[model samples]
Target chain A: MNAQAADKTVATMAQTRPLVAMDHVSKIFSNGTLALQDMSLTVRGGEFLSLLGPSGCGKSTALRIIAGLGGVSSGSIDWPSSRINSKGLPEGDISFVFQEPTLMPWQTVFGNVFLPLRLRGVSKKAAEEPIMEALTAVGLGDFAKAYPRELSGGMKMRVSIARAMVTKPRLLLMDEPFAALDEITRQKLNDDVLNLWRRTGITVIFVTHSVFESAYLSNRIVVMKARPGRVHADFPLVTASERDALYRSSEDYRQACEKVSAMLLEAMGDAPEGH
Target chain B: MTSSVPEMNASSERRKDIALRIAVPLVMVVGLVLIWHFGVVMSGVPPYILPSPGAVLSALIGDWSLLFPALVVTTKITLMSLALALIGGAGFAIFLVQSRWIEIAFYPIAVILQVTPIVAISPLILIYAPTTQVALLICAFLVAFFPILSNMVQGLKSVDHNLLNLFDLYGASRWQTLIYLKIPAAQPYFMTGLRIGGGLALIAAVVAEFAAGSAGASSGLAFRLLESQFRMNIPRLFAALLMLSALGVTIFAATSFISWLALHRWHESNLKREN
Candidate 1:
């Protein structure tokens, strides 16, 4: 949000460690739709990566496979920096934020944030401090007793983020978590997320269609194409200076946006109409 | 002073809204009773053929000893059947939802039972059950069972796919997913089932007793109505009918209150709209 806050987050030492790698991963849905084809990607330990693409590009499918929500038809995923579980995926060190907030309607804000810890068999008393910490991290400390229905769209998304972060996961997968929010709320959340990532040093793989958002938040962007989906372009948007409102208005940011936009258009051009 | 004035106005307006909701319904009921009393008196119908409101009131007080015991019998049967249905339906739904194969195998059987009229099966239940009370309970339980099972099944299946993915990403065990996610997610639907089943349970209990025609000292209000009709005690029959209607209304109110309690904080159906 500001130059000083961004300066503190430029400590990029954790980006080199290979965390998980997909080797020629391909997924064909039961209905015979090929969602992804021969897609290989390695997610590092602490980098902010964005899977940027249009609809049907399988960016979501790729993220799902990485999170072990879907299986590859012809390839395997390897975890180099984390231990593999019996399911052959990374163990219980991951969290996912859905496009929708996805909080339980019956639960209060605190209860929703308590879910991941509760599922892992942590007692409520033991989970109190971490739950409060997570809530505070998301700026929802005052809404601990409020139900999901009482919150605004942005606040509900904040609860979702709190829920995801409560476990102090090593990896966080966000599937366009702010896509439904208004622009102002989305921008605010982007800054908050960047700050949280900086403070925790957690790895984040964010999926998005917004060029501005991806350009602003991601250190690395993977632009994907549809029609038997696969990655078409991969690039780093590293900046020597801190990214703030000034950086956004800068010519460097304008060029980065133009570059990503042109690549997205090219990817869209490759796919058929109505995609 | 300006802010406080609007706040006081809003509070008073809210109180007035609550008062109007209760007052209008009470006024309607009073008006209906007055019309009925006058209509019966003006018609000059004999008390045996049609009892006036005053006659009915006298009968209600005069027969209170008999009617109270009968009301208790009916209430007990209704409540017990509802409890059984809740246990049976929710348990079966959970069991069926655990495996698609199990749901596919058993859901049709549940549908068959639901479609078959309870009236058609009441005779068989009466013949098979060890006691008349047991037969009445069985009929009520059968009537109440389907709505709960159907709603709960739909609720369990309706869990957001992304939330399921989030749970999977966290390596949540099946039991943990059921308890922490699926069950709470299914609550609104479960409450809906309870409301519908509550009314159905009462209807089935009374109807089953009527069909059984089992008259004894311990017989329900339905039996008292039949006995009063047979003995030309029309005023007492009206009293029993009044008690039955009151019981039905009470069950509906109680079920609705329970639903409101469970869902008012979060569910869309229970939340009050601002406009």
Candidate 2:
């Protein structure tokens, strides 16, 4: 049902503003693993999209390819008005948060968050306010002095989020960031990330294996399949864009989740088992 | 914020844990010394072969004036070589990591040097070097270099691929990534190498002195060991051996202290936990 709506909206999105476009991109490892195959995606400007799939479906590989972390063996990707830099990154700045917290464990919370700007040659003195602001955004204003080892898992993930946001990039990529957190912490972070996206209007490409999470957070959901990884279903999430606690219980959200779950099951060549 | 009762308890528990850590090690050392003393007294080994603990202690005190200068000389050489190895090893490792060709082409040479016994090459090194001091320095450097190089290479390569993706997203240059991500991430591994290298450097220094002592003009502790042995000054020989052991212990402790200082804030190696 949602696929028809997505097909219609996708055309309008492509016409008005396409922030990034992947054209039949494929990636194969030297060990002969086909992580991605003939995958094409169009990420519209300022959209919250999630690539939802099972473990080996290459959602992460797709995200990495888009962020220029991994190279495509065939086909190409294009960004609006700018080509890739010599380093394979888009000319515009990008930020990525990995599955694990991946904070420099030896660095303090403030130092970890300050890294992107520091990498761009900003001194600590000059970066102090921005670093504090990033930490504060994640509600860790007083915990800047803490080390990663001293932090709880949720807090460390927050630090990772702050580090990704420090650069104020045009694009942000996050791979299974909240998967390790408990339900309550994950919900809190989900709301916080939505708030950040609303405030910054940065384009986001999120990857996750959670059906409910993708249905709740994303405007569009890309369901992918494994073996030779490729997109199985691309559809508009029918739930409201300004989602909240109410949306989680609303009939639309339930339907969207069921729809995504069914798509995923079909993608994996399995009969859908009711949740 | 008000300190909770549980928080106060946690802090006190941590303090107690640290005290126990120190106290346990201190007690063990004293116990071992007592056992050594009693065993030697019971065995009645001749002083020339195995001096009694008291006699060795007395020799240490009586010969302090002579032994102190030799200790200082060996220490200077060990420290100098260690510093040189750290700089050269890390620099070359970074260079190797910059290109696959460079790493593949040169890594074998490092392995060859590491496998070739330093004792076997010392004579050749002495002949080529301009002086005895230079030859000793070279020997120490060769022994210490491989750990820093190989461990650092392993460290540089072991970086989380996701973190590398994060760097790439931010368009961090090779140099920027090295300083910001790779170098900081490599700390634990580098510290491991440093601890091993520290002990190896001292061993190499003493061994080099032994090889170089053939010139008979050496003033190092190893040369002193030789002179005392030749004269059958048993107590002094025991004193020299004690001094050498003391030096090794000191270097090990110093390096461990450095690793602690560098990583206690974040790495698991230095963490103090309640449990």
Which portions of model 2 miss their true places by more than 4 Å? A1-16, A28-38, A81-88, A225-228, A238-242, A265-275, B1-58, B214-218, B273-275
By DockQ, the best candidate is: 1
Interface RMSD for model 2 amounts to 2.4
The lDDT per prediction is: 0.89, 0.84
Q: Write the per-residue lDDT of candidate 2 for residues A96-215, one digit (tens) a residue.
A: 888799887777898888888877779899999988888899999999988887778899999999998887776888999999999999998998898898788777899999998998
For A1-275, candidate 1 gives per-residue lDDT tens digits of 34443334444434456776899999999999999999999877777899999889999999888887877899987777777888888877788999999888788999989888887789999999999999999998989999887789999999999998998888899999999999999999999999898789898999999999999888789999998899999887676555777777888788889999999999888676686
TM-score of chain B of 1: 0.95
Q: Which window of ten consecutive residues has the lowest lDDT sum in model 2 chain B?
A: B211-220
Native contacts present in candidate 2, fraction: 0.81
* Residue-level lDDT tens digits of model 2 in B36-87: 7888889987888877778888988998988888888888889899999999
Off by over 4 Å in 1: A1-16, A272-274, B1-10
Cα deviation of B57, candidate 2, in Å: 4.3
Quote model 2's TM-score. 0.86
